[model samples]
Target: MKRLEGRVAVVTGGASGIGFASVERLAAEGARVVITDLNEATGKAAVQRMADAGHAEAVDLVCGDVADEAHVADAMDRAIDRWGRLDIAFLNAGVGGAFGSLLETAVEDWDQTFAYLTRSVFLGIKHAGKRMGEGGSIIATASIAGLGGGAGSHGYSAAKAAVISLTRTAAMELGPRRIRVNAIAPGVISTPLAHRGKESNLEALCARQPWPDTGQPADIAAALAFLASDDARFVTGETVTVDGGLRARSSDVLGDNSMLLAGRTGMNRGSTGLKSGFRNTDR
Candidate 1:
């Protein structure tokens, strides 16, 4: 049987990038999907694309800002109005917000960052959780930046970290109802949010990765599908990192040979009270 058969899902930011990819994947997996986004034109085009692909019966569109609580409620209401129930909520809308040093960051930018990324997820869970039944999954788009530094900009990282923390707390509260709450911490994917400038080179970005392959939006969509499906029934309050090994190696491991000297001198001790060691094996 198809994984999401008879399911009804609402995906915010469903016009493009990871959100659009999730919308497509969920619909293709036998769920009736409602795609919500800020751009009505793009949202309509996305639905048209689905219709052209013969998924017309499986998809719908709602145009609104995800950060707005009223809009969020309306989206969920529309999903239930058409499908009779809500089973999955993918609160994936976000903005890059503040991108520079924290010292230079303005308070307004910080507020906007959380309003867009963190608050949107909070509202999604609040409204979606109320309408969900025995089996429901709520997934949010976090970032590797939320896990640590050097992965994202200042306000964006903080907002995503809040998303992760909120997911854990929400899962604990919603566990009794058989509803699952989870977050996806994606690495540097080739999306408009990842590379800012219109002239940015995605190929160059991919070459810098440990695996040398840029993560596609589809990779994240596939992960979201898994978490939304019964396959992840036992998983909740957890973050599934899809970072392509970016977080696996520390700066010491990826840095110069000075780490080797520090290791020998006992100056490279980590928080675990063990000296960092590097080994090269000729296989």
Candidate 2:
């Protein structure tokens, strides 16, 4: 659609998964894209694929770690040097934490999680916002876990929650400069990260989706492209959920007996306060 024509975008972790998909989408929409990834070889290959597809001038690759401020700053500087300006920045680099409860999680794991997920986003916003003068957009890849309590991994949930809060505050602060900041909360997307586990678990997770299927990297890339385009000029301080309706259904489910008892005791009152034992059962 050429929605991002003449614009310049920097995507961290752009060698794989959602970040790579975003790079492809932005390039297709006529934006000059610079990819920053920790994997040097894959990052170059990703750019080469784009160049081979006749987008040679529209793509650039930078090898770096998002968790490092110097690397991020250099990446941004490279984009500006090439394209002369930066219009969009997608802070999509993140690492899955070790699966464990809060008490079982180690301090180093928590530090690494915050470094890659939360602190990386912070640095992206700080440096990208400075390079982009006015009318720029910053989109971060937050997860559906950011919206509520998570299961299994405490570090991932906490970091994602911090990302959401950071996005909102940045939106408010950067609004004065016409810089929009937003986040996308994706659910159960089939990517390299998810496939790193057992195939059975991945299948089971996908099967439980409310919709007919799970999400893909492109699904999130589409949402991010929209947020980056001028069409979303008025969008800010918002989080768009692209989870295929999985999260919309309330997670609270009870047995028939419990439902019957609550109904009989007037505990399941319709959005109205009611006394049930020692608790308010209006929900």
Candidate 3:
């Protein structure tokens, strides 16, 4: 039998990239999943694709903004209603957040950044905790940028740091209920959210990592699967770094004030037309 044979999962931002890879991984492990994304078309297409790849009955799609209180709450509720139980909740929906220099960042950009990157995680934990049973696992997507400087923009880094904090605190509160909360701090993954179609630059920048290979969405998905399964039953409130040594060394795109562009501040572009998620925003 598969590791997660009888489990049920909900993955936000499940339309593509890391999110889609995670959804596929979880489903392959035998978990029935409800996919949530801002774009209904993209979400449905993804469900169809996953179904075609086998496990046709194991995946479903739900569309909503992750930051909205109503949408987030309902997403969790619907998963339980459909699957009869919720075992894993991957609160991975996010945008690159407000990019560019801190000084030039707009107030609206900062607010929206938190809305997508931070608030959504909080809502996922809140609703999922309420609905999850013992042995449940909750995972959030954090960033290496949250751990240190230069890698991400001002607002994006701040928001991810908030996510890491939220995970620790939530894990403490939910431990008694047997629900585990944790965050993954990914570095330089080769996703639509990372390269933004700069395939040339993508390979060049990502391969600069100490590991030499570009971090892929499947790599993160594998870690996420472990956390969601019984394999990580004893782990909670930890921020697992999956950056391929990106954090151990200096970053070229990190805002060092040397290559910092002035007056060009906005949310980075993304695959969903949400905050552009290609977070290497110095360009």
Candidate 4:
């Protein structure tokens, strides 16, 4: 049976990476998918490819900046106008952002990161929720960095952390209407966002993962499919992590555990040099 037959879905950042994979997966499951991205040419090409792949009737393309409220509203309007309703919203648009130390980071960069990463999700939920009926699913692309620091840059991590927090809060507010809000916290995925279109670079990093294979966009897409289907009808306000066991073990898994373990024994080794490790020694 087609899991999402007759359903309508909107995927932001659908031009590439996990968003594109989710668009494909949902369309394969019989969803009428609306692909939204900032790059008009790339987005149109992606939709054309889907059409070539036999999903012609199931795909539409909408190009816009997700961070712009007007653009977001228009995208939703376009979806509802075409399909008469919206059933799934995947707020996955984001930027790599400027990487630097706290003092070196610019305020404008921070604002821009949050605007696209966090604010976009908020706007998506706001508009999508208004148009949805009883059984809608809203999912966002958070990051393993949201859980801790080592996973990403400062601005990116902060934005994703807010995303994780927002997912729970949105779920609480939307649950009364039978709308499910959740998030996917992906680890180092082999997308342009992480590997910069370099497969060899991604493969090199994959060697350190417990799964020993870099996470493909399809890996996260599978999770998106599940969350969008009836299989996760009871799930909401949860952040499902899709890291290849990267978060299970610290970055220095093969390195010294003595420093971390020592902190657990109440050792006062407080310093301002290193970043992202156990800070409390109460245990």
Residue pairs in candidate 4 whose N, alpha carbon or C atoms collide under 3 angstroms: none
Which regions of candidate 2 deviate over 4 angstroms?
A: 197-199, 252-283
Model 4: which ten-residue window has the lowest total lDDT? 265-274
Model 3: how far residue 254 lies from native, Å? 4.4
- lDDT at position 38, candidate 3: 92
Q: Candidate 3 at 21: error in angstroms?
A: 0.1
For candidate 3, write residues 108-131 as lDDT tens digits: 889988998999999999989988
RMSD (Å) per prediction: 11.2, 11.6, 3.0, 8.7
How many clashing residue pairs are found in candidate 3? 5
Tens-place lDDT digits, model 4, residues 160-232: 9999999999999999999999999998787876765467756645676799777889999999999999999
Per-residue lDDT tens digits of candidate 2, residues 40-118?
Answer: 8778888888888898999888887788999999999999999899999999987765334344445766686788889
Structural similarity to truth (TM-score) of each candidate? 0.86, 0.86, 0.93, 0.87
Question: Which of the predicted structures, 2 or 4, would earn the higher lDDT when compared with the native?
Answer: 4
Best by lDDT: 3
Candidate 3 RMSD computed on C-alpha atoms after optimal superposition onto the true structure: 3.0
Error of 3 at 191 (Å): 0.8
Give lDDT tens digits, candidate 1, residues 16-102.
889889988998899999999887777888899999989999998888877899999999999999989999999998876654445
